[model samples]
Target: MDEITEGTSQVDCDILVIGGGTAGPMAAYRAKKKNPNAKVILLEKANVKRSGAISMGMDGLNNAVIPGHSTPEQYVKEITVANDGIVDQAAVYKYAQNCYEIIQELDGFGIRFQKDENGDFDVKKVHHIGTYVLPMPNGDTVKKALYRQLKRARLLISNRYMATRLLTGKDGRIAGAIAVNTRNAEFLVVRAKAVILCMGAAGRLGLPTSGYLFGTYENAANSGDGYAMAYHAGAGLANLECFQINPLIKDYNGPACAYVAGPFGGYTANNEGMRFIECDYWSGQMMQEFYNELQSGKGPVFLKLNHLADETIGEIETILHEVERPTRGRFQVNRNNDYRHGMIEMHISEIGFCSGHSASGVYVDDNACTTVQGLYAAGDMASVPHNYMLGAFTNGAVAGEHAIDYVNEVDFADIDEDFIAAEKERVLAPTKRDDGIPPNQVEYKTRRLVNDYLQPPKVTRKMQLAQDRFAETRAVMENEMVARNAHELMRSLEVSSILDCADMAAFASLFRTESRWGLYHNRADFPERDNENWFCHSILSKDDAGQMTIKKKDVDPYIIPIEDEEKDAYDKQRIKAQA
Candidate 1:
């Protein structure tokens, strides 16, 4: 590794994996495994032991794609229908094909998945068309499992270093990345042959209705850093308007774990205590039905586990309280609520970009390769529909293996000193200001605007106004936002990322005139879905003049073609029994 001197801190590696969350550690592990001699470095904003989306751990695999349980073709088609047919089938197909492999690998790593009496993987039907949700009874230690593997791989791990930007070489390929220590405020320059980003999602882009900034469905730290870095590096981000809005525990702002509890006879119910949607699987159509039920005369939705047996409810509590958010039980107890006696109130989550649940992230091919050479993305940050946790692991392996091959073909590129100096100046500017806007205040205002204008049933005028307000907010972030310490500096940088995502969301929403993805990208003005011109993926990138540009990219021809009947399967998510 050729180290380039940039002040006091200089680090070099054969491959650099940013965001040591669900996908990142796996990527680092696989990169080292693929090329044992090459040095692989993993960077994280927090401890690798527990961070990102699965910080608490996953409830279950939303898309297992297990062999006997489901096929890649079937899994691909289900995701295609779920996303309103605007997905790159190849990308989803790749995830489907390889995810099962990772599930078994995780099993070897000591992460347990629930199995049947016959010793078969217990897969449940949650989607409109497939049985993919695999419960993890002891999944709270998923991060621990990954951490063990990362340690065994003997890779370098840097914790509390938040990567802010991707450094490009003279040839315009990924050379390395720039980051800062959230603990000490020391700037870091990582020079590498290849870089992989697994920065989770833009979870903090929208303020939760609870009025708490940290109370988001996704990990609070995932404030669109990957999206911002990828965009600035000139990578294409797909379906920014197809935001991630989950049916979460109201006010508490965490998953209600319908995917885990649904099979145990738990269902989403309206105030009348009747099931509204047929499937609990999260999709745009499912959320639309959820939103409509809340708006309907029988308002306020609830996760109805009151009908379950005491034994079943006990089992549910064990899984819910122990895994995933873990705070669901505490939050419920504070309200004096129990699943056996009362239903848990549910609400639609704040809008943000997360390809793990929704189809909005940096575009990547089957191998996790982005448009920019030597730059790859996986996990919630990569554009693969309904990928969930298993997808992140599988895609991480793909990116890591491919990145090793990529680095072998290309030699290390020199880092430009001027570019490094400019980025350093920009990052440190917030701390330099004696008195300026606090990052939290700026974030709150920007996210409030996100909810006011960009949260869907979007309107042309509202989105237009959103653009104007976003521009002003971006200016505030660029000029006025202040950071007193390294932690505040992290927040300040995250605010910038959130602003970038806000701009992308507003511009992308306005660009796609037709409303699609059900409640996700619903335009009140254009209430109808226009497949004629809008069927293709809405790709966004920074133009030459540094303005956000949107263009329609043809969806890669489907490997597993969707039947006409199957296309509308997601559109009819509401149960006829409710009607």
Candidate 2:
């Protein structure tokens, strides 16, 4: 706690991008690309070899790079429909327009796509926006391709870095950030005029039992890091209640669950072998229709069908290096291909298991500006509210371009020496200080509290208890926290995020007052959708400490004049060309 201190090296730049994952890289790339003279640097906690969700070269770039049965308009339509009237239609159209470009951009960076037996591009069939399957490619390849360009640009990469707190200028605008280099235990003060927070959502705020869909079996690294930093800085967070859970798997590392497809019609079952969708609660019948064949006692072993053809196998071989073994005196793909070989046997459901997409995050204007001055968020860190995963790439690109434009217009200055020194002194002071509650301990306690009492489900009693308990835990943490240095300061911040965001997430969950959606959040108290009580957005902010103040925002339902349908179609076609 008090023993840990913040890093001390001070360096100023034009733009400081956080979280070297998805949006982070594209932001860094676009920033520098737009402004050739701008000094750009990306501060990544992880290394160039392993940053971004695309690092492994197999993340399945779902924006649809290949031609399928559907057109770009169809893609946009699917996303809008699946999102259930909550998607940013404009953003969807924008992303859909650039979907091919994103893939082409990645390929230009040396990421090889799976080719047909005749050495041409190939496509794979995947689940569509909802019930059907659509063709897409592996996503990990996308990450590797981005890495290639980043290396070409010589973007500054600070690996093994853990940023604990954001630095602000005299005007209270987000100026830069301070972090620790875990490898050598040194301090780094990154000063930038513009900061983009790409940190993921609430996996870090809940109990160990709480998890993302594909990430449920594996521990999550997203501590709502971006959410925490933005919230305290006056950013509004929306739709925090929309946490998606993939109930298909108990673990990503355990035995495959191929049998679920049998009893549940075409859908897979949980370990209980019961078609959970059969419960009386659901009225829409979307999930239940999927449950029939897989839930039937005599279901087929759809798991054994091999989906990864030769091209996919080759792509797998090219992307995974370290995980590969030697074949013919040359290393080939070293991966869980054994699992794929058995995907049809039992793990057929694994294909549908990754539910941790960012449905909600920091609220930003159409321009991608957050509530805080000189700070902006885009990509997954910002809330699409009504959009799904298809938007992350296009959104990242848009945000990157916006940040570059923003930096050009803002009046910039050098790094504040006083702030850096004070941070340095604060970090150094911890070594001289004595015992205090550790950041890890504060974080652990807070997560345990939220995971136990404050899930997405909003019951009256549970919400009140969670609200009070979250407040209590935050008070205890703040009081017990003893930090004279930078390291200790960060520990305090990490704990602060969980405690503060727990109330934020809970408030949003309670205000919604319905279990209208979410595979995991079933509210017994609010049994039905009370659109009257819950139609508006539930937004939360902080007044220092972790206390939550809730506000309601008007829902702007989309409208298009019926007679102008032909004109709208022409406009859409035009927008597609520009995008």
Candidate 3:
């Protein structure tokens, strides 16, 4: 092997938006629109033109807060109920209020939303209440539309750089970030007045049952970078115990897309083709029911689309195959299964953290401001429950707009030399080692352990055991993991982040004693929702000693109060069998 050459580069920007996926681009674009003269940089690990969660593009807005469809208050109530009442209503409401504007703005940018014959928005109900699901039959071009708008905004674009750690100033505020060029192995020291973390979810933390690392429900690139970065930088992440386990196309590992199919009369069913759940909304409660049915000797579950008319089936195929994950059609064809004749097999995805579908992410307020000064987060990585695509856009807008105002108030601070040197050594260590455990192997092992121990109906001893395995994985990170090249180096760094998320997941799960959020945090040992004691957010952060610390923070008072009778609206989602 040739001698590995190391290089360094520095950049100065007024605002830095990390992860160009659904949120980062919006953040960067909005920041530039807010202050065109202010230097803004949109940094992405992959091509900004196609990256993050919506890299292939999304099928529709899972949470579109449009007029005549849903009110922000009703949306808030639905999300709160969906998430089992452990949510920051303020943050959720903010997204609900502003998401419509972002949708209109995207529409103006040439992104299409399904409209009725009467010219009003064609919206559908996927949530237990309210019609929030807005389909985009041509939604595959969403990233392209955003890319066009991003170019129009003219923000500086840095692609193929994986952000490893956040840099803090002497004042303990976010000064910048440390990143490496994934292709060339060039180290980067980026100095920005404000940094918005929109690195999507920790999708790669767990191995897909297919044993394909990249075959995750979320984009393969989201390896918990934002969650780990924020935690190491002392940002509090909430409800990590509330893991992201979606009902996906078995083995293919993507959404069976209840939101898209349910409106067209497609529903999740057991082998008997009977609807078990009243609603197809992807919630913890809904998942709990799905899991129960699958485990209840009705072993294999499926998306029942065969019952639909030929025209409807054709429409579903057009939306499912053309938009979002286009690979699903090929997967079905390869398996010799057609939606018109057979039920699409469904399975529970391996555990991960995603605020898009379930509530587990870096805790942020309504303004998209994280607890850490000068650091902000949004999208699936930030804790705004069930924000989905539209939430990502609205929160990205919030982060970008607020960051501009923040940058105006703050000045560039000096980066700590010791910290920089330490981070550099940490990131470059894998490259220096000749051979040891490969990054893919380490990631796979850690994720396999996650499935073995942390998939819920959580047992106390099992989670404790998961912690022990995670500690072993941490040991592997320190002593065994190796990278042969820059791309491998990026994977190696991601393994460390995944380990951090795994440890946090186990720790947070153990801390929250009572079962809640349906299958998301269902503790087998304590099978009850203990609102009197455990109703607040379970926040995890690194302490002074660099140890993971768990604390209970009160859920902010609700702006829109739920009636006592309505609190259990999502509890009995299962449709009982007729005697």
| Candidate with maximal TM-score | 3
For each candidate in the order shown, give its overall lDDT on alpha carbons: 0.89, 0.54, 0.90
For model 1, the superposed segments whose C-alpha errors exceed 4 Å read: 1-7, 577-579
Worst 10 residues of 3 by lDDT: 1-10
Which of candidates 2 and 3 reaches a greater lDDT? 3
Please give the lDDT score at residue 3 for candidate 2.
40
Off by over 4 Å in 3: 1-4
How well does candidate 3 match the true structure, expressed as C-alpha RMSD? Answer: 1.3
For residues 206-301, could you state the per-residue lDDT of candidate 2 as single tens digits? 544323322322124455567776776667776676653322322232212211112122333233332333221111122322233345553432
When 1 and 2 are scored with lDDT, the better candidate is 1
Once model 1 is optimally superposed onto the true structure by TM-score, how far is the C-alpha of residue 33 displaced, in angstroms? 0.7
lDDT of 1 by residue, 67-181 (tens): 8878999988988898889988987888888888888889999999989999999899888788888888778889888888888889899998889889998888888999988
Q: If ranked by TM-score, best first, what sequence of candidates would result?
A: 3, 1, 2
In model 1, how large is the Cα lDDT of residue 1?
14
| Counted clashes in each candidate structure | 0, 42, 0
